[model samples]
Target: MMTRRGVQWISSAADDPEECREHWALDPRSPHALPAGRYFDVVAVGQRVGLETFDQLQRHGMPLGPVMADRASEQVGFFLPTWAKSPFDRMVRQETADRAPEYRYLGENSVVVVPGPMPLAGDRYIWLRAPMRRPEASLPRIAALAAMFVAASSVVARADRYGREQSAASVDGGATHAH
Candidate 1:
């Protein structure tokens, strides 16, 4: 936090000067103030959380941008959230690998912490990064996800066509099953 001319501020306080300058100054609702910054101009399913983020933008008089449903192989079940092959799982693992331990899962002796299996209401959550503040800095991951939708869509389409062809061939042959 900084106080300049008696106006105290709690914004991006990242020790990296440039990072603080780029991300800390903007709130979830601020018009993306960077006239230029490294960013992918696309999005994927997990980025759907932007619905909440953008709502904040609208509430604060900020302009909203285009949002499209992405179709990446990587996003097949991430946001829509099916089990086993969720992209969110792999993404979380990868992030954990790249990050220092958050200890979100650990107790003082490294014991597992649990709020138990009880479902939390609202079924909603947000990923929060700290220090230099922003409601979400998840944009980079979203951009990367836009690439995976293609692979998922390709496999789905091919399976659909194969199923259709098999059905046609089966009908043409007058196949019969007695069970």
Candidate 2:
């Protein structure tokens, strides 16, 4: 899923443990790019989910798996679980109590892992997790954004002075174009 500009994106930002999604977007070639619009993926941490939605996704054949510490999470040690419908689905244990760069917010009703190809009830699966910070490594991006805004502002000012008229329009002013 390479964008015309050649930026690559992950299939599920929710599944990405490191939250290095913005950097991955800079790669200039990724499957995450949409045909249009600048979109940033958001992950919901430990928030309650509706039973209906959960059941719907589950009935759709959602598979649960242990969270793998991605390259980003590897730096820490937190692992998250993902759902079959979306890889971003993950879970954080209560013991980890993330108090650093990020914390794995808990979600209700995580899948029970079976053992020996069939984990029965009353089974326990031990997982290792490292403390994490939400939106880690985002400082650099903020700096970059400041710089980009300044550059764009300067250009816009110059253009306005030259009478290059531009109209202010809302993003969704009754336009129904696809992203």
The best candidate by TM-score is 1
Query: Which numbered prediction scores highest in lDDT against the true structure?
Result: 1
TM-score of 2: 0.18
TM-score of 1: 0.25
Predictions in order: lDDT: 0.29, 0.26
TM per prediction: 0.25, 0.18
Tens digit per residue, CA lDDT, model 1, 44-123: 33333333333344455432222222222211012211121334345444544243221111112221111111113221
lDDT of 2 by residue, 1-179 (tens): 12222112222323342343453445412212111111232222111121222233335443221221122222211122221112222211111223211323222333211111122223232121111222232333323322322333344446665543222223346344445
State the displacement of the C-alpha of residue 174, model 1, in Å, after optimal TM-score superposition: 8.4
